[model samples]
Target: MKQHFFVLAALCFAACSKEPVLPANIPTDNPALPANSFTTFNIAKGNHYCDKTAVHVFSDSSMSVKVRFDSSCIYKTIDPGNQDDINKLVGFTEGNNNHLHSARFGWRWSDNALRLFAYSYAAGVRSSKEIATLAIGQEAKLRISLLPTEYVFAVDDTVVTLPRALRSGIANGYWQYPYFGGDEVAPHEIIIEIEEI
Candidate 1:
């Protein structure tokens, strides 16, 4: 009887303890997106990739999209550096069948903010840079413009530049979708809504 009392007391204490502070501007609930125009990407818990979407060939000078993330975007990584790992946002490969030479916008939740980035690979070499920070539940305009010698990433009003691997030609590759992980799968399910613009 005494042991049961202690266990119940402990449970009560845990339940009444204050919860940790969360980031500001977090959405309390997921918002609906127009199904006809917006494509929802869901990364399941313990998974690295989102549910398969229609595969499409891409050959464009720039890829632009409107992205909205929910409260589920907030997460803690096991490794500090993993927080820096940018998850694929939207992008395409450059050249035919050359994923090693491609460009894309990436995103992650780190430092209590939703951060976007310019991520790419050139001749099998990878590079990434923080482009902008957005709030949860806010729709952000993200675009990656291909240039002769560089790739420009623009998010809303912020612009960041990165070197392009394949210059002087349009990006002719397949489209990339949302993916989670640096070395770890998503700790929980994550949902991202995107619409090409």
Candidate 2:
């Protein structure tokens, strides 16, 4: 009878001590994928935000990440000119509560190819510059360096610089993830594989 009671207590403790489960939509390292370092971000159809919203505090002078886009990134917009509108890639919002004081790498499928851009906002003003064109399914290294007066954005061989609002310090904020659309949500489900290097 004592053995039975002990067994029941053990089982109850085991049941209550299980690890917490993450939501199904959160981005996680999939062993099935060829590279475990890569995290696949999924943006559902008709949604501007990706499934992953994991927050990361960043206070570094530079951030670098490698990203790859699959065929799902290819899409046509209702308005032809909207094709040039840049979508947020990897970045972080500077200061507090205001995305207007931020810098990020941007990408878009335009002119029959995938292109990367240096996108940013300084003191509530917006600016973007085309950095380079990258091939789909190919990993590209992107880096953003926060400087006293500007931001240095580099994608492989190409580099572009944009103005920085804060004159003298490292960035302090949360990491931003993949996002879609300027005037429209994702045309279809989009999958982007990213690994911070």
Candidate 3:
């Protein structure tokens, strides 16, 4: 029957031609990007948390950590609306709560000054950003780039990109740094550096 009328007119010209769907470029900001996109953590343990003492000192590379904060408060302030100590219960999470990706930068204790914070958690949901202001030894360089969903928060040159959810997971996890939660410590006598740049 005339080749089924040219196969029903080529299936009605391929269902009237369809095409429109473009999204996925990634790079929310700070795109002078280079240096392998991000992945550097080698701090040879200099762990010490004050208020009851908690120590884990041992990170060999001369990245010294001996901040025995026995209290003499050289400058420690936090109680502005009382975020229960930087709001996060704030720990760089990894694995189930929903799904995860975490990032954390240092030197935080803001009220009047001394802030250079960057915190993130995805899937279970949480976010924080202070970005700059510090002087206890003044030296900052925080970096995090873990993508397979989204998470890129770099500091000192500032870059914050976020979005997470793809099964919501991070099974390649590891992050712990003088983590003091609920019971605080380290009021002075500082010297913590597990830096790798």
lDDT score for candidate 2 against the true structure: 0.84
lDDT of 3 by residue, 47-135 (tens): 23422222222211112111111112133434334323541211233542312445555444556555545566676576666666645
Best by lDDT: 2
Give the Cα-based TM-score of candidate 3 against the true structure.
Answer: 0.24
| Candidate with maximal TM-score | 2
In angstroms, give how far residue 46 of model 3 lies from its true place: 46
Clash pairs for candidate 2 = none
In angstroms, how far off is 61's CA in candidate 2? 0.5
Question: Which regions of candidate 2 fall more than 4 Å away from where they truly are?
Answer: 1-36
Worst 10 residues of 3 by lDDT: 61-70
Candidate 2, residue 93: CA error in Å? 1.4
Cα lDDT of model 1 by residue, 27-125, tens digit: 324322333378788999999988854455677788788999999989988877788677787788875443478788888988789988888888877
- TM-scores of all candidate predictions against the true structure: 0.77, 0.80, 0.24
lDDT of 2 by residue, 1-197 (tens): 99999999999988886677877765555322233388888999999998877555667788888899999999998888889889998887787543578889889999899999998989888889999887889999889998898999999878889999887578887678889978889999999998887
